[model samples]
Every structure is written in structure tokens, then in C-alpha cells.
Target: MNESMEAGMEQYLTAGAAGAVAGLGVAVPLGAVGVLVLQQAMRDRRAGAAAGAAVAVVDAGYAALATAVGPLVAAALAGVEAWVRLVAALVLAVIAALGLLASRRPAPAGTTGTAGTETAAPARVFVRFAALTFVNPTTALYFAALTTAQGDTLRGGAAGAVFTFGVFAASLLWQQTLVVAGGFAGPRLPDRARVWTFRAGYGLVAGYAVTVALPLPAL
Candidate 1:
């Protein structure tokens, strides 16, 4: 290959690699969203996949924004950080409450399927999950810091797009793994067990909300 082609390939590869690492860095932590994803996966694979995809898309969008203007966006968010965090905590609390209530109620007889239990329609699931993931500006801040640290590796429009795609791909891979694991495990679990499992997941989400609302002192 000629020098220009070699340089182009290297740029794409570097951006993609950086994005993959950043994606995993953000997604790997089993936070409230992660717990919900696993729980939804246990209940319905399609809904879980839909939820996961929404999260990946939002993550990618944030990554792109961060790459294009990391410092400026980060600075803008800092002014309203408290409000953003408050909104996130409240939303999470509401979701947890709804999930707990849903677990107690019997599934509509026809709705629960062979694969697992039923959730809202996949389209609704996608919007809800997307909103849940997008409300947290911390994810964007994370990518902003990462891009700043990496300097120009993620610069340029083409490089940014490739990086965003890489983030989406890596995040989707991890999210789908959780979904598949839950799907496989759901069938083996008794109905009572699954219901309790969902309850526990919601409880965790509630706890996460508390953490988000109140900052803990550094150890």
C-alpha cells in the first residue's frame, strides 16, 4: 500500500482501538443500568437487546461529542452537574419502584412467552432505555476525559466517526453477552426464583440511586 493509504489505515485502527477500550471502560461496570439490562434479558431477550442497543447508541453519541469538543462540553456540563445528577437519581428511583411493583404483579397470562417473561414492547423499551442511559452526563464526561488524555488520536471527522462505531460495537458486544447469559439462565430458574431475582435487581437500582444522589467521601 502507498503512504497515504497506510496512514489512513493506521488512523482508523488507532481510533477504533481507543474507542473499544473506552467503551468497555464505561460499560463493564455493573451499575444500575447494567443490572436492569440483565434483569430485562432474563425476562425477554428482545427487550433486553433493544435496551442494550439504545445504551450503546447513546454511548457512541456521547463519545462523538466528546471527541469533537471534549473540553467545551465538559465545561458546559460542570455548571449544571448538580441538577443533572439529581435528575438521574430521581429517574433511577422511579424505574426501580416501577420494576419492583411489576415483579409483584402477575404477568398477563398470554404475554409471558416460552423464552421468558414479557416486558413492554421493544420500541417502548428502546426509548425508555435510551432515556435512562442518556440522562447520565457522566458517561459523556468520561469520554471527554479519555479523549483529552489521548490527545489527537481521536481527532478529525472520519476518525471520530470510526471511533464512535467502535464504541458502539464494543458496548453492544458486552451488553448482548449479558442478555444472552440472562436468557439462558432464565429458563433454568423457577418462576418464584426469577421474580425474586428481579426484585433484587430493582433493590440494587434503588441503592444505586441513593449513591448517585448523595456523594460519598473519598476513602
Candidate 2:
């Protein structure tokens, strides 16, 4: 097959096997991710399992999608042909620094489930989380690194396209799971308990920052 020849020749262009595996690692946050999860748990305690599930879904969805298509995204960037190293480094440094700060921020009032006496504003809450998460700079770094590493694998035309679709599917599956769980837990938690739950959540964020920056010497 003509495609087979292209596949064979492609190995010469990039890291291939090792790079594909590495793509997954670039987004594996040892620190901030946990903090966010815990924070979500605390915030959604009153929200019931559904709220928690939603948080998880969004988190996992983004991560998995970022991992799978990272290569394609990076390839697009490679074309920019600018001072990429400098740019990536600067961006990463700022993100790491911000993570440290975000960890220390005061937890917001209200459990994700805790609703105003008026008909609960589910849409607004969902939108709020989306905005907060999408704005995080570290997310950009994670995706950038992943895509850059996967860029080679994604160049194989049809095979590459299939891989990206699989990645997207996996991401969506994980995120949706989280959303369902959060929704279930939304209405079960109490007042004071929810507040400290989030403090713990922020603590995890702080932890993530430390882990990413220092990367505890591999055991």
C-alpha cells in the first residue's frame, strides 16, 4: 500500500514510539490536578454527586483530549517558527508561579451544590467553572508540551487522524463520568463542612505547583 511506505518513512521524521508515550506524561500533573479535584469535591459536597461528577468530567476530558491531539496542535505551532523555546519557557514559568498563587487564594463562598434560595443557577455555575478553568495558563503549557511531543505521530495522515479521534473520545468519556458523580453529590453536604473542604482543595492546588516545579526525584 502507498500508505505503508509513508508510514515507514515517517519514522525518520520524529521520535515516534517514545514520543507518543511521552505525550501522555506532559499533562500528568502530580500537584495542581489533585488540588483542583479536592477543591471540586469540597465545593460540590453540598451540590451532591452530580456536581462532583461534572468537575471530574471536565477535568479528565480536557486532560485526555489535550494528551491525544497535542501533537497536531503543536505541529500547527511549529509553523510559527518564532522563538518557541523562549516563549514556552516564559509561559511555563508564569503558569507555575500563578499556580502557587492560586493555591493560596481564599476559597470562594458556597458549595457548588449550595444554591441561592431562588431557583438554583446551574447554568451560571457551570459557566463559572468553565471560565475559571479555561483561563488557567498552566493548562496551555500542558497542552503545548503534549502536542509538541505528539506532533510526529500525527503527521501520518489517516492513522494520525484516527489516533486523534480516539484521544478525543477517551477525554470525553472521562470528563462525563466526573460530571455525573458531581451531580449525584450536590445536595448532600452541610455549611461549615463545605468551607474547609475547599480550603483543603486549594491546598491540593498548592501541592500540584510544588510537584510540577520540583518533580520529586524519581523513586
Candidate 3:
């Protein structure tokens, strides 16, 4: 291979690697979304996988946006940070309340006691999580900072595509791990344990709502 082409390939590989690392950094912290995903997994693997994919898509989209026009979005958000947080908090609070209520109830008649049975559709779950994850402006800022640090490695063309794909793939991989763990653990847990676990997950989500509203440090 020619020297210039070899150098380009190396750069693309490096960008992909960097993007994957950044994705893991973003996803591994087990925040509110992560907690919810795990809880969903315990109820139904398909639903959980759908939610996880949504998160990955949003994360990759935010990363791409951060690389392309982060400064502008950041600047715009700064003017309405409080309002944004308020909306996000309200949404999260509602989700937590609904989740908690759902946990308390039994599965609908004639259906299995799983999210797959109760959730209506995996596509719906995906849309819901995609919207939820997209509301967090912090994610975009995070990618923005990383992209800035990366300098030209994350610029347009082949590098950008590889980086974005890497982010999506890595995030999905981590989410799948959570789903698998939750799925396995769910079957083994006692009935009471399962209910309590769901409660705990929703409770954590509630806590996240409060933190987001307060604009405090969060996972």
C-alpha cells in the first residue's frame, strides 16, 4: 500500500478507537437511563434491547452533532439551561412515577408477567428511550469536549463516519451487557426481590430527576 493511503487508514482506525473509548466512557457510568434499561431488561430482554439501541443511537447522534456544531448548540442552551433542566426533570419524574406504578401492578390478564407482554411494542420502547436520552444536553457537551480534545482526528469524511459508527457499536455493546446481566438475574431472583429491584431502579431514576432539576453533579 502507498504511504498516504496507509496513513489515512491508520487515522480512521485511531478515530474509531477513540470514539469507542468515548462511548464506553459515556455509557459505563450506570446513570438513570442505565438503571432504567437494566430494570426493563429484567422484565423483558427484547424491550431492554430496544431501549439500549435507542440510547446508542442518541449517543452517536449527539457525538456527531457535537463534532459538527457543538459550540452553537452549547451557546444556545446556555441561555435556557434552567428551563431545559426543568423540562428534563419533569419528564424524568413522570417516567419514574409510571415505572414505579407499573412495577406494583401484576401482568395484564392472560399475558406473561414481562415487559415484552405489557410493553405493547419494542419500537415504542425504542422511541421512548430515544426521546429520553436526547433530552440530556450534557451528553452533547461531553462529546463536544472530547471532540475538541481530539482535534482534527474527528473531522469530516471517513474519519467522522468511522468514529460515529464506533461510538454506536461500543455503546450498544455495553448496553447489551447490562441487558444480559439483568435478564439472567431476573429469572433467578425471588418474586419479592424482583419487585423491590424494580422499585429501586425507579427510585434511582427519581433521584436523577431531582439532581437534574437542581443542576447538581450526576452520574
Q: Which ten residues in a row have the lowest lDDT in candidate 1?
A: 110-119
- Over 18-48, each residue of candidate 3 has an lDDT whose tens digit, in order, gives 8899899999999988987887787778888
Cα RMSD (angstroms) for every candidate in the order listed = 3.2, 9.1, 3.3
Q: How do all models score by TM-score?
A: 0.89, 0.44, 0.89
lDDT of the structure predicted as candidate 3: 0.82
Q: What is the Å distance of residue 40 in model 1 from its true position? A: 1.2
Candidate 3 deviant stretches above 4 angstroms: 114-120, 215-219
CA displacement after TM-score superposition, residue 8 of candidate 1 (Å): 2.4
Model 2 spans > 4 angstroms off: 1-31, 34-112, 115-153, 215-219
lDDT of 3 at 5: 93
lDDT of 2 at 121: 45
Task: Give lDDT tens digits, candidate 2, residues 98-133.
Answer: 544544455446533332221234455455445434
- Expressed as tens digits, the lDDT of each residue in 47-165 for candidate 1 is 88998988999999899888889977777776666666777889889988987877767676777732223567889989988988887656867998988787787865889889988
**If both were scored by lDDT, which would come out higher, candidate 2 or candidate 3?**
3
